[model samples]
Target chain A: MGIEHDTLVAISKSWGLFYLIALAIAATAYALWPSNAKRFEHAKNSILDDDDKPLK
Target chain B: MPQRADAAALSYRDCVSAKIKCLRYYRQQKKRVSRDRVSLLFMGDNDMISQLTSTERQYALVILVLMSLCGLVMAAGGRGDPLGVHGFVVLAFSVGLAFVLISGFYAPQPDPEQQTQYYDDPTKVGIALTMAWAVFGMFFGVWVASLLAWPDLTFDQAWSSFGRMRPVHTTGVIFGFGGNALIATSFHVLQRTSRARLSDQLSPWFVLFGFNLFCVLAVSGYFMGITQSKEYAEPEWYADIWLVIVWIVYFAIYLRTLARRKEPHIYVANWYYMAFILVVAVLHIVNNLAVPISFGSAKSYSLFSGVQDAMTQWWYGHNAVAFFLTAGFLGMMYYYLPKHAGRPIYSYRLSIISFWGITFFYMWAGSHHLHYTALPQWVQTLGMSFSAMLLVPSWASAGNALATLNGAWHKVRDDATLRFMMVAAVFYGIATFEGSFMAMRPVNALSHYTDWTVGHVHAGTLGWNSMIVFGAFYALVPWLWKRESMYSPKLVEVHFWLALAGAVVYVFAMWNSGIIQGLMWRTYTENGVLAYSFLDSVEAMHPYYIARAFGGLLFLTGTIICSYNIWMTVRAGKALATDNDAEGDIPVFARNAVQAGE
Candidate 1:
């Protein structure tokens, strides 16, 4: 239940460093991932299924 | 012979291709059913089957890639405590990979014949499970309270041992009973409304498996004393990671199914569910920002410091109540109320308004939990203000549900499920009102660190959440299992009154004890010395504690009877062939069929 101030500070630094690295990796992966047109079309079709039909 | 073999092989390939096309058609039919008002209920089974198609494969793929990337980053970061993070990454990968692989191998075969089969009624299973767990949890609670009161009692006293089983009661009801029932019923409703089958078999299994697994780990870990010492976020780092993975998959599955929905507009219930999912994810991540000393170690340190840590922890803690306990149950309210009453929502506009109001206001109210503490005074003020404002939305939603039952008071007498839901709304009103009053700074001075807070929580969890869950289970099980009626409607009535009375007695006694202790603690001798030893407060609570245990026992007994009734209903009662009955009946998917024909 009790934590020393110095120990707390050290933990925060480690967390900061970890988060930064995580952000960088996520950014790079997003850039490198392949774009699939078929998949996009499927997703769009799934959402707009009944929109194209006239209302009853 | 060689020529015949070659022809058979070619035909097999053709069959596979044909099956893919059939699945696509089923998916389209599923969408049409959702758009149709009269056919939605029938569409749920079909939509679940269509989820194995390649059309929705991208969502699964994206989740896998993201989970893998997160793992890689955590592994490479090498923060000298990568074991827990690494284990999570690996587990996530396996779950994701397994889903993708299964979807590929089982590529949905479209039924050219267009036959529909419905089995394994998830609603019935969920309802039965929820009732059983509710009873178990209540009894366990009574046992714990009895031990806490009788200090001389040893661990060998099965019904009076409090030290090891408190978490069991809490987790059993909340996570095991209530949580599972919500997921099961929601899954059924989502599919029906969306006009889509579950996207993939593996995903549903993953959800059910992962959730039960977390429950197992949590209860066992509690007894083992392997906690992070945080309330609600009790399971250590490993358990937290597993939950995170399960949650992401849950979110992705929900979104994917929504994408395939036949309805042009998302229902009010889905919005509440999304809010619950999104908010809980944010709260879980922020509150659980800690570093495990090692993978096998039971120790970890929260990344926040001093006042900031306290602020962040309570923020996460309180909102877990807000989103997980409150909002998720609100989602249940939206769907189950309308469905049971055979009425449209009282006002969609009101639902939207209340949703936004709750999300915006609940976040700030977390700081109210830290009133009169080291937290900044301004922060406390903001918390109190938001806590007061929260009443508007909370009551708005409660009002909406109650209004939907207008002109339908007769149903409350005949149907125990509707009765449970209606009373839950009342409790929601009461608990939120009490919460706002307690958040005031002056009131908190007396209420803080008293039994009053405990009463407030039970009012919400037991009275509000438990009642709605029971109602939902009562409505869902018979419908899901196609049962004509419960084995014993009398038992449901008994369960309801017993549980309600028990909750009232429990909350009222604690309220009295809490206020008395608060007043005693603040009382001063003539010379300004403390008037009461802390022991005096403890002694004052003895009677209330004993009363609470007795109340809990009554609630527990009621729950057991309810569970037994449901189990018998599933096992022995004649099944209803369709949703149509003497009760107001509206099929969920007929609107889409009309549209498709047009």
Candidate 2:
């Protein structure tokens, strides 16, 4: 017999959960990557440069 | 003998040049004085001058003429078709615009050396409107609370009844006060973070004026018994259509500005603002789909009837809170809190995580508001699950804000504005947690349709949203006016205590009253008999309602103080230059100090 409907529903739920987890981890990894460290640091301090002087 | 004669000639020449140099300096001073006199003719109000670009100046001239025309038409229309309360409001606003334009003829200069590079004038006006609305909204809220305490206070008119005044308070605070604050801060944050000016000047004014026009229509229509009966989406068909147009322009302005960013990466705050703008448009359009009874009439029927309509309205309702209040204010917090504390955000990564989580989850959680309704079980479950998941991001944002203040906690103690931001974050955490808990079906069974939900909303609006907004206002007003500090720090301190005490009293009174009401409703005796009648519960709530009114009064008093403080601060800035004047450097409050080589 084919898989029960409840079983299929359960699998979908778990899959959705797994997908979101993977996405979260990927986002975290991207943020923490060594290559991104400098770029992100620059972004954090970016507002400090917003002085009243004209932009070039 | 010849060498001695040449030396004497050289000495005579040096003496003559020294006298000539002194004469030239005196002549230059006279020329400078003449130039100053000429400049004074053009710059009557040096401090309050138009910062509009050339293109924007043209737009202002066109808008001024058009507004006057519209004002004349509305004035002639009286209470006739196409010009009811809407006409009067338009006329009033047009008069205001005319006054501004007339002033510009006399004082049409920008203090380039003192002002921000970006077009910040719109944001300044928006903040002023925000405070005006805040006081008015809080006054209505106090009135509504008093009416609940003593229903007889509503006079005799249907327009003055609790049913009517309730929406006035809600719409006034939500759209009038909170909406203006969002637009103002979003513009401020977007420009600073992007390191660019707004895309254009005219569109900002269009959005501001048009949006407020929608608010006026909504509120006046309510007083006139016009409604679609949807909470938070109560404005009838025409008002909704006007809002759609205004919102589209808002979104376009935001997107255009983002595209013009000098920075390579978009800031986290912009992402939140973008979401707020886009999602609100979607929600407003989808939930307000309706057919007007007639072109002239204000009545309309919602396109989706019965269960579908309920689901759609709540979807719009809950997300209005999610997007309009929470997301937008969170955007405000991310920028202002860190900037005010003079610290970088604790973790940019967490901001990313929370942004993604909240944006994705909040849309799904709207159904939680319809938990026990005719909505299907599975849909409710999905809503509850998403709401529970939302806790992660909500706490992340709150935690992120608190952490940003790690080494800058002294700022919170010393600066009332920073303290307001800190307390707002704390309240945000509390409200979000309570939101998830109440979403569960079991708890909703007890708390739904009770004052508990009301308490929870105030906890968010008063404790979270208003606190952050007050902080931004305090920071923004002085900076906008080119002042070193507020007129009185002691007043800020007093306002803070009043706000804190008011919120605490307001929230706890609601908690006690809401729980009691909820418990009474759910109570049953032996043989399946009800322990208390519905009227009994209402009677019990009388004292609590009065307490809530007192609490609202305190909050109202605090806001009035805050407004007074801001007004005096602007006056002080006009009277004397502070800070940067001594060194001829830009004021620290005007913009953040840039580090070396950055």
Tell me, by TM-score, which candidate is best: 2
Candidate 1 per-residue C-alpha lDDT over B1-598 given as tens digits, one digit per residue, 9 for 90 to 100: 9877777876676567556645654575456545643223323334443434454455555555565565555555533443434545454655655563454445566453221221223443445556656666776777777876887664565433454577777787777877777677677667655655555545765576567667766766666555676677777776687788888988887898788766666665777788888888888888888998754554688898888988998998889888888888998888777777666666555676687778767987998999988987867887898899899989999999888888888988788878999999999999999999999999999999998998999999878998898887777666554455667888889999998998998899889999999999999999999899999989989999999887778778777877777666655544333211222122222223322112
- Listed per candidate, the RMSD to the true structure in angstroms reads 13.8, 8.6
- Tens digits of per-residue lDDT, candidate 2, A6-27, equal 7756875898679778877887
- Choose the strongest candidate by lDDT: 2
Ten-residue stretch with the least lDDT total in model 2 chain B:
B38-47
Model 1: residues >4 Å from true position, as ranges?
A1-56, B1-129, B154-164, B577-598
Q: Residue-wise lDDT of candidate 2 within B1-598, one digit each (tens)?
A: 8777777776666456545644653564455446544232222233223655445666676876776676565446544543445656666776676666555544555454433466676787787788888998899999999998888888888888887788989999999999999998898889888877888777888888788888887888777777778998888876788789889989998989888787888878888998999999999999999997665556689899888799899889999999999889988988888777778899998898898888878987988888777887777898899999999999999999999998887888988999999999999999999999999999998888899999999999999999999998888776665555788889999999999899988999999999999999988999798999999999999999998999999999999999888766654333222223322224345343432112
* lDDT of each candidate versus the true structure: 0.70, 0.80
lDDT of 1 at B225: 56
